[model samples]
Target: MFAGWVQERAGETPVRPRDGRLFVAGEGRQYVLLTYTLKKSAFSLGAQNAVLPLLAQASNAARASVPSAEVIQAGVVLHAAAAGQQASREVHTIGVGSMIGIILLTWLTFRTFKPIGLIVLAIAIGFLGALSVCWLLFGRIHLLTLVFGASLIGVAQDYGIYFLCNRLRADPQMDSAQLLRRLLPGLGFTLLAAVIGYMGLALTPFPGLRHMAVFSAPGLVFAWLTVVCWFPALIGAQTLKAGPIARGYKSLVARWPRLTNQPLTLVLVAVLGGVTVLGCSRLTVNDDIRSLQSSPPQLVRDQIKLSKLLDAPSPVQYYLVRGATSEEVLQREEALKRRLDPLIAQKHIAGYQALSNWVPSARTQAERLALIDARLLAKDGPLSMLAGEIGEDAGWAAVTAAHLRANAAPLELEAFMRTSASEPWRHLWLGKTEGVYASIVALRGMRYPSIPVLGQAAEGLSGVQWVDKVGGISSVLGRYRAYMGWVVLGAYVVVFPVLFPRYRGRTWRVLAPTAAASALTLALLGFTGHSLQLFHVLALMLLLGVGVDYGIFMQEEHERGSDAPWLAVGLSAASTILSFGLLGSSGTPALQAFGLTMLTGTALVWLGAPCFIVTKEEPNASPVLA
Candidate 1:
C-alpha cells in the first residue's frame, strides 16, 4: 500500500532519463529517495551550516509520518559538515594544549612572570604580522595554516630567548644598546637560515603548504624584529643570576665528550654512521591522498550504506563527453554507455547514469517512434487483432491507431531539462560550457586498480575524457613528495654560501649537527617502517633552520668563552620539543609525521652539537672530531 501510494505520487513526475527507478526502488521491500537542493555548494560553510536544520526538519517529518521508517542522512554536504566540525574541534584542542605547554615551559625557563609577558608579547607581534600579511596576500587563512602555526610558538620564541639569555650573562653596567649590538650577528644569521628554509615551502604549488609558509616566514621576521627593536628597552639591564638549570646545562656541556678526544670519537662515529647508512637504505615512500584528509568514521559508514542501498554511481570518477551541440553531446554519451554495457554483462561494472539514459537524442527518439508505428500501429497489426477479440467495430481499430500516431511527438532535451522530472539528475547535463556542450556519465563499482582498463573505453572516441579526481590527487602528492625532498637538499646548498663567508673553514662545524641530525631522522623513520612523505620532508627543512641555530649558538659561545650559550640552546630545544611533541600525538597523519620528525631530530641535534665545540688545544681538530 505504501509502495502503491509512493508510485502514484512519484510516478506523476518521475526522475527523468530513467523514469521512477531513481525515486522508488526495492526488490521485496520499498525505498524512497528525497533530494533537497541547497543554495550554496555543499562543501561551502553556508551549505554545511544549513545541513543540521535540514536534517532536523527531515527527521521530524519522517518520524511524525511513518514512525518506524529510517531517516538516513547521506550526501556530500552532510559528510563535509561533519569533517569540518571534527577538524575544528581538533584544532581547538591541540591549539589550547600547545599554548598551555609553551606557557609553562617559558615560565620554567626564566623562573619569572616578567619574561613570560615579554616572550608572549614578541610571539603575539609575530603572529599579528604573519596573519596580516597572509590576509593581504592570499585574502584568507586556511585552517591548515593555523594548524601548522601552533608549532611556530616554539620557533618564534627563539630570538627573544637568545636576547634574554644574553642579558643573563651581561654585565650590570652594560646598557640595552651594548647588548643588542653584541647579539645582532648571531640573531641575524639565525634569521637568514630560518627564512631560507620557510621560503622553500612557498615555492610549492600546494596551497596548504604555501599558506603555512606565508604564515610562518613573516611571523618569524616580525618576532625577530620585536626582540631587536623592543626587547632591550623592556629588560636589558634586568639580569638574573644563573638558576640551577642553567648551571646544570653548564656542567653537562663542560663534561660532555668532545670530538677532539681521538679513538673514542672515531668508534662512536663509525657505529652511528653504520646505523645511519643502514636506515637510509631501508627508506620507502607513501603518497596516498586519502591519508592527508580523512572524514569521520560514522559519516563514512552512512555514505557506504546509502551507496549500497541506491547502487549509485561514484561522484569522484566519471567520463566527460563533449560536443559542439546538446544533441551531439547526448549522442556521444549514448555511445559511451554502449561501451560500458559489456563490462556490465561481465559483472565488472554494476551500472551507470547519464542524461542520455532519460532524454535520448532526436535521432534515437525518431528511430524508436518509427519502430513502434511499424510493429504495432499498422492497419493489420496487434491493435486490430485486439479490437477483433473485443468484438469492437473495425472503425475502433482505425481510430485508436490514428490517436497513437498523432501523439507520438519526439521528446526534446530542452523541454525535458526544464521539467521537475530532471531536477535530481540536472548535474549530469552540462548544456553549454566553454562553447561546447558536455555531459558526465557517472560510473558505479569502479576501483582505482581497474582505472587503466576502464579508461580504455573512451580511447579513440572524440571529446571523451576519463576523469578520476582521487587518482589525480594521489599522483600529484607523489610527484610533490619527491620534489620537496630535492628542495630540502637544495636549501642546504643555498644556505652554504651565506655560512661560508661568515664562519669560513668553520662553516661545516655550524652546519654539521643539522645535516647529521636530518640524515639520522630519516634513517630512524626507515628503521621504524615509517614511509617518507611530503610532511616529513617539510619537517626536515624546518629542522635544517633550527638545528643550525643550535650549532651557531655553540660556536659563538666557544669564541666568546661564555657558558651561557649551552643554557640558551637547552632552553630552546626544550621549548621546541614541548611544542612539537604535542603534535606527535595529533590525530592528523601529516601533522603527526611532522611532529615526530621534529621531536626526534631536535633531540639528536642537542646531543650532537657539543661534539663540534672547539677548545684552545683543539685548534686544528679534524671534522671527524679526532
Candidate 2:
C-alpha cells in the first residue's frame, strides 16, 4: 500500500494505515498501533472505575496472545483512574486512622462518648454541606478536593472541642448557652480568619486549589454553625470532670513558656530568626507536574518502553492547526510538515504525523492527477504506447479507463472519514471548533526538544500553535505559587486588622505565632531538602487559618481564666497532626507536601501559641497560666 501510494501520491490509502508512527527503525520489524475511542461520559469517575477493569483485562489478554509482544496501556483515562484509586485508598486509610485516633483521644480526655458524638456530627454536617454545595456549583467534586477536605476532620471539630473544653471548666450552674456565649468571640474570630485563609486558595487560578478552597470554606462554616447553633441544645449542661489525661495536659499547659522575660524573649527570637534565615536560604522551588502524581514504577517503565519502541511523541505535546476550511487546515498542516522535515533529517525529532499525511489537500490531489495524465493517461503517454508496442488493445483500454476514473474522483477528507481505514486517525481531524476548521499535527521521539526550536517551527505559519501541556501546567503552578505566598502574607495582614479592634493590643499576639510557624515550616522544608511546590504554599494558607485558631483559643481562655485552654488546643493540634501527618505518607507528592507542611506548621503553632500569651500580675489571672 505504501509503495502504491508513493507511486500514486495524494491518496487516503498511504496515510491512514500508518498514523502517529514517528519512526520506523528497521525494514524487518512490523508495528501495529491500536487506538481506542471512548464515549464522552466515560470521563466521569464512576464510568472510569467501570472501564479500568475492562482495560486491564484487554491488556492481559493481548499480552497472553503474544508472549513476545508488549502491550502497554496509557491515556488520560488510565492516569485519572490510577490517581483516583490512589486518592481513595489514601483518604480511606488515613481518614479512618485519624478518626479512630481522634475518637480515642476525645474518649480518653472526657471519659465519655458524648463529645465524640458531637464532634462526629459536626464533621458530618460540614462535609455533607460542602459536598452538596460543590455538587451544585461544579456538578462533580474532584478527588483532590476530597483528599484535602479529609483534613477538615481535624479542623472542623475544633469548634466543638473548644466548646467542650470550656464546658468542662464552666461553673456547675452555667447553662450551655451561657458557656457558648462566653466562647463565641474566640470561635467566631477563628472561623472568620480560617475563611479568609481559604478564600486565598479560591483566589488562585488553579482549579484543584479553588475546588479545595470551596470544599473547605463551606465545611468550616457548617461545622462552626453546628457547634454554635446546635451544640448548646444537643450538649445540655452535664456533669463533667477533668480526667487524669486532661489533668496531665493541664499540668503541661501550666508550664508553657510565657516569653515575658526580656532576655528569654530575645533569645527565643534570635533562635527562631537564625533558623528561619538559614532554612529559607536553602529553600528551592520545583513546579514540575510529574512530581505531583506519579504512576506505578512498572507502569512508568512500560510507558517509557512503549514510547521508545514506538518512537511516539509526548502525548501531551502537539501542534493544533486551524483554518477557515478543511482544505485550509490541510494546507497549514502540510506547511507544518514541510518545516518538520528538516528537523527529522537532522535527528532533532524522530517523526511527526498530520491529517494531511493521510488525506491530501484538493490542490495536491489535482497536481497528482495531472502527473498521472502526463505520465500514463494521455494519448501519447505510457498506456497507449505500450498498447501500440504489444498490441494488447483490450487490456490497455481497461488500464486507461481505470486511470481516467482515478483522475475524475478526488478523495475528500469527509468521504475518507466514513471509511473503516480512517478510524484510528479520525481524532486528528478536528472538523470544526469555535467556528474554525482544525486538526492536530502530532510529534514524537523528539531529542532534547526545546520550546524555542519546536515553537519556531510554527512561527512563520498562520493558524499553527505549539501546545505543551506539561510545560504550561508547570508554568501555571510556579506563577500561582508566587501568588499564594503573597496571599498568605495578605491573609495575615488582612485578618490582623479585623482581629485588632476586638483584641486591641493583643492582635499581634494572635497573629504572630502563625506567621512564625509558617516561616519556620518553610525553613524546615528548605533545610530538609524539600523543594517548595504550589501545594506546599497551599498548606501554609491552611496553616494561617488553623494556627490562628490555636492562638485565639489560648489568648481568649487566658483572659477568661479558663482552667486549661491548652487541653482543647492540644487536642486540636493532635487531631490535626494525626489527620494531616498521615498525608505525609501519601503516594501523591502534592498530598505528601501538604501533609508535611500541616504537620510541622500545626505543631509549631501549638507550641508557639503559649509563648505569646499576655500574662497578668493580678490574683484574678488564671493561676494555671502563672
Candidate 3:
C-alpha cells in the first residue's frame, strides 16, 4: 500500500516541458537523475525495513504472471544477484578449507588430540573476547575490526605452541611451576612490546585501528594467560618424547653454524642487507584507501554498470550548511549555489543538489515575483502589451493577482516537508541537529581543489562543515602511517632504555635480531614488488612480537635448561609461519600481505636465533643462523 502511494507521488506530472526539457521536481535539475536508497547499517537515523525488497519482488512476480501488464518492476539487483551470491559462497568455501587446514597443521605437528583441543580453545576464547569488547565499544562490530581480530589468530597460535612445546622439552626433574617461571619473562616481554604497539594504534583517530588495538592487545594477553595458567596443570612434566618431525627440524637447523658462522658470510650478509635496504628505499609507498579493500572484479563491473545506468556518477564530496533557523539555512545555501554556479558554467564541476534549490528563501521568492511584475505584468510590460495585442479578457491587476496566488507564494521548509514532493529530497535535511538546522549540498564530479573552495566559502558561517568521506578516510590513512612512523621511532627509544637495566651493554644483542629481521623482511617485500600499506605495518606489529619472542625465548632457554635449543623455538616459529603462511595464501590482498610479513619475518628470526647462542668454545657464539 505504501509502495502504491510512493509510485503515485513520483509518477509523471501534467506540466509540459519547456523546449522539451523539464526539471526533475525533487532534484530541481534540468536532467532526470536516478535515485538509489543506500542504507547504512551504522549510526542510522531511522528504523530498517526489508519490505522494499519484498514489494519489488512481488511486483515483478505479478508483472510476469500478467502478460498484459505494460511495465515491470526491476532493479540493479537483477543484474547483480548471481555474481554477488557466487562471491559470497566462494568466500565461505575458502574460509572453511583454511579453518580445516589450521586444525590439521596443529594436529600433525603436536601429534595429539589434546594439544589440538587446547590450542583451539585458547583461540576461541581470545576471538570471542575480542568480539565482545568491540561490541561494547562501538555498539556493533565493524567488518574491518573483525579482520584485525582475525590477524590475532597467528599470535594466538604462537602463544599456545610456545608453552606446549616447552612441555615437550622440559627436564625430567622440572615441575609445572618451574616451567612457568622459565617461560614467564620471555612471554611477558614479547606480550608487553606487542601491547605497546597496539597502544599506539589505539592513540590514532581511526576507529578501525583503535578497535583493532583494543581487540588484539587484550586478546593476546588472555591467550598467553591461558597458556601460562592452564598448560602447566593440564600437561604434567613427564619427559615427553619428541615426534619424528622434531628430530628432522633439529637436524636441519643444526647446519646453521656452517651457513652463517663464518666471518666471510657475516661480511657478505652485511652487504646483502645494504643492497636490500637500497632496494626497499626505491619502492613506493601508496596510501590510497581504495587499495585497502580487494573488491571482486564482478562486483566492480556491476557497480560501474549501475552508475552508468543512473546517468550520474556518485557524489564524493559534500558541503554542509547550517543556521539557527530554516530560512537562514536556505539563504546560506542560495549564496553557496551562487558560488557553485560559475564553476558549473566553467565545467569545473558537473553540478550540485540541495533542498534550497527546490524551496527558495522567502526573500528570494519575493524578489522573483517583483522581477516578474516589472518585466511582464506592468502596464507597459511585455505581457501587458501582448495582452492588448491579443485582446485579453482580464485587466493587468487581475492577471497579476492570479499570478501572485499561483506561483509567487514562497515554499517554506515546514509546509513543503508535509507534501509528497518532499519525500525524494528528505535525506538532504539533517534535521534539527544540536538545535541547529542543517542540510547537505552534494557535489558531483568534484576534484580536490573544489574542497578547499567550498570550505573557504563557509568560513565565516557558523555551524557549516565541509565533509568528504572518501578523501577524509584517505587522509586519515596518510596521517596514521606517518603517526606509526613516530610510534616505531618512539618504541626504539623506549625499548633500549627499558632493556638497559636488564642487559646493560648486551642490550644491543637483544635488539639486533629483530632489527635485522624486520629490515630484511621489508626488503623482501620490496623484492616481491608488493607495496607496503597500513596492513603491512599492522602485520609488522605481529612480526615485532614474534622477533622479540624468538630472541628473548632463545636467551631464556639458553640461561635455563633445554634438551634442544632450536626445537622449542623452532616449533613456536614453525607454528606461526604455518598459521600465517596459510592465511596469506588466500586471495585477499590485506591477508596476503599480513601472512607474507609474518612468514618472512618469523623465518628470518628463527634463522637468526643461534646468533645469541653461546657455545662452550665461545661466549659470543660464532656467526651461525640468525
Candidate 4:
C-alpha cells in the first residue's frame, strides 16, 4: 500500500521502495520519527542525517543517468529547502532595508559623504568580523545562530551613531581629539553595560544564546574601534545646519520639562509599575522546542499524509539504554522492551523496536537453549516422543550437544553489526562511548506525558533514558532560561554597586529607562498572554542591551544639555527596532519571539528614555557617564 502511495504521489513507476529504512543509514545515528523539517526543527541534526545524503544521492544520480524513481525528493527536505530560501530572502531584504534606512537617515542628518561612507564601512567590517569569530568558535554557524545573532549589526550601530552624533553636537572649534575625549567616557560606559548584558547570555548553556552574545559583544567592540580610530580622520570637523530631523528632535525635547516633571507623570509611572508587577506574576513560559520551530502548515500536512500512508513512526520521543558492555546494554534494553509490552498492548504507544529483541543477550540466548533442551531433548520429551512415533528411538537417544548445536554460528557483536542484514538494527545499536555501550529503543507514535509514564514504568532499571528530542531540548531551554534569569539579576547586582560611587544620588536615574522597558515588556507580555519561550528570554537580553544603551545615552544627552545627541539615540533606537521588528515577524517561532520582544521592549525603551532625562542638570554634575 505504501509503495503504491509513493508511486501515486510521484506519478511514476514506484519512485522508490516504500520500506522502513529509518535506522538503516548512518550506522545508527538517525531517528525514524519526525514531524518537522531540517532547518528550524529541534531534531535538525537527525533530520539532516536522513535527508542530506538522499539529496546528495539524487544530485549525483541526476548527473549520472536520466531522471528515474531513485531521484525522489522527501517532502520534509523540499519544504526545508523552500524555507531556507525564504529565510535567506527575508534576511537579505531586512539587511538591505536597514542599510538603506540608515544611509538615508545618516545622510539627511550629517549631510556628508565621509560620515555615511565611514558608518557603512564600520558596519560592514563589524559584520564580517562577527561572522569570522563565529566560524572560529562553532566551525559552522547553525541557522538559528545567524537568525538570532545577526541582530548584532544593530548593536554595532549604536557606537557609530554615538561617535557621529558627538561629532555633530561637538564644539565646532574643538579638534577631533577633544571630541574623542568627550565621547570616550559615554561610549566606554555603554560598551560596559552592553557587555554585561550580552555576557549574561554567554553564561547560559545554550550554544545559540552564547553565539549571539559572542557575536554582539565582539561586533560592538570592532564597530567602536572603527569609529574611534578611523572615523574622525576620514571625516574632519564638519558643522551641520539644523534640518527637519534636528528641528524635530529639539521640538520633542522642548516639551520634556512640562511633560515629565508633573505629578501626573509620577502617578503614571507608579500605575505602570503596578501593572507591570501584575503582568509578571501572571506570565507563563512554553519551553517546548516545537514552540520555537512552528512547522509550516504545508509541511505539517505532508508529514501527516506520509505518516498515515506509510504508517511511519512519528515518535517525538525515544529511549537510550547504556551499560558497560553490549550484552549489558542489551539486557537493560530488553528490560525496557518488557516494560513497553504492556504500553503497546494498551495502545499508549503504537510500537517499539530494540536491538535486544533482534539480538538477545548472551544470557537470554543461553536460557533459550536450556529451555529447548529441557522441553524437547530430555527423556520422554518432544524429541523422544517424535522419535518413538517415527520408530527412530536409537537415533533420538544418540542425540548430543554437538548435534543440537547444528553448526550454529556464535552471535559476535562486531560481525553481526557490520553485516548488511543487520542494517535495520544498526541505528538501534548505538556504539560504545567512553567504555559504555549505548543503544536506542525507538517508540513509534508517542508523545509527552506518555513517555513520562513509560519512563516511570521502566524505573529502577539502570541506564534507561527516555529521550524526547523535543522535551529534552525544551528542558535544556527551561534550565538555561532559569539560569540566564539569575545571570541578568547578577548583572543588575554587580553593575549597580560598582557604579554607586559615581552616581551616588542619581543611581536610580541610570537604571530607570531599562527598568521601565523591562516592566513594559512584561506588562505587554502579560496583557498579550503570550507564552514566553526560550527565545523570549534571549530577546530580553537584546532588549536589555538596547535598554542600557538608551539609558546611557539619555543620561549623557541631558547632563550635557545638548538635545542633538538625542537625535543619534533616537535614530539608533529606530534602526534596532527596524531590524528586530522584522525579525519579530519571522515564520520561525524562535526568531519571531526574539524579534517581537525586541520590538516591543525597544519601543518602550524609547518611550521610557524621557523619564531619565536630566531636566535640571545640577551645576556640579559630573561628566563621567554613559
User: What local distance difference test score does each model get?
Assistant: 0.81, 0.82, 0.66, 0.70
Candidate 3 global CA lDDT score: 0.66
lDDT of 1 by residue, 151-213 (tens): 788888888888777788778799978988988998999999988888888877888789989
Superposed model 3: Cα runs more than 4 Å off: 1-114, 124-151, 237-239, 257-263, 323-325, 345-348, 390-409, 431-436, 444-466, 559-563, 585-589, 620-626
lDDT of model 3 at residue 578? Answer: 63
lDDT of 4 by residue, 246-312 (tens): 6678778767542254578667768877988889888988887766656566667656655544444
Q: Pick by lDDT: which candidate is best? A: 2
Model 3 over residues 149-256: C-alpha lDDT tens digits?
655666676666767677776776888778878778767777776677667668767776788788888788788888888878887775345566655765675555
Q: List the candidate 4 regions with Cα displacement exceeding 4 Å.
A: 1-87, 111-114, 136-139, 148-150, 169-171, 234-239, 257-262, 294-296, 307-316, 388-402, 405-415, 447-449, 497-502, 617-626
Candidate 1 has an lDDT of 0.81
Question: Candidate 3 at residue 257, lDDT?
Answer: 57
- Best TM-score among the predictions, by candidate number: 1
Candidate 3 lDDT score at position 550: 68
Tens-digit lDDT track of model 2 for 557-576: 66565655778898999999
In candidate 3, position 474 carries an lDDT of 77
- In model 3, the Cα lDDT at residue 557 comes to 60
TM-scores of the models, in the order given: 0.87, 0.85, 0.77, 0.82
Q: Quick one: RMSD of model 2?
A: 5.0
